[model samples]
Target: MKQNPTPAPIKINGSNIDLGEALPRKIQDELAHVAETYFGHLNHATVGFTRDGNWYCCTINVQVSNLKVIIAESSATDCHKAFDQSLAKVGRQLLRRKQRVADSRRVQMSAAALA
Candidate 1:
């Protein structure tokens, strides 16, 4: 069995925000798995948490490729919830990208077969 490489630490930027320490380990593991399973390689990831009057906002930026960047954000009552939501949003985007590539390949194959 082969072991997976560890993911890079997420960078958090904002004053008066300590969400980085509060980030759930499960979410971090899920993000690492997403990188390996979807992107095939780990890229840089940045997570930012901010607080408004009554809400918390989380923003995540993932660099999938040299020209492709995935950004996801969410606002919730707390930092952890917002962060989880943002992670899920990013996962959905990655899934969509994978599906698009697979669909394109299938279409090309069918076209070639009919040619």
Candidate 2:
């Protein structure tokens, strides 16, 4: 069994709002897990939150590898909900990228086998 590498530290920034205890540890853990599970390592991650009127906006930018960068944003009535939405979006993007890479490799292997 191989162990996944530690993920990069996450940087959080807030605008027009006081984050104070709002960024949940569970969400950070989930983000780290996603990075490790998808790419085994994370080069960098930045999460920014903004408040506009009654809505909260969350943006997450994650660099999983030299060739991959995932960015997602969402807006909701609460910061936590916005963050969760952004996380989910980023997870889907990462999964799709992984699937695409796997599919390309599989195709290449099959082509080579036929040659």
How many pairs of residues collide in each model? 0, 0
Off by over 4 Å in 2: 1-6, 22-24
TM-score (all chains, Cα) for each model: 0.78, 0.87
lDDT of 2 at 65: 73
Candidate 1 per-residue lDDT, tens place, 1-115, comes to 4444766665666548764454656556767778667867657778777789789988888876453889999999988788789988988999898888889999999999999
Error of 2 at 57 (Å): 0.3
* TM-score of model 1 (CA atoms): 0.78
Q: Worst 10-residue stretch by lDDT in candidate 1?
A: 19-28
Candidate 2 collision pairs: none
lDDT of 2 at 87: 92
lDDT of 1: 0.77
lDDT of 2 by residue, 70-113 (tens): 89999999888999999999889988988998999999999999
Error of 2 at 1 (Å): 11
Cα deviation of 69, candidate 1, in Å: 0.9
Q: What is the C-alpha lDDT of each candidate?
A: 0.77, 0.85
Q: For candidate 2, which ten residues in a row score worst on lDDT?
A: 1-10
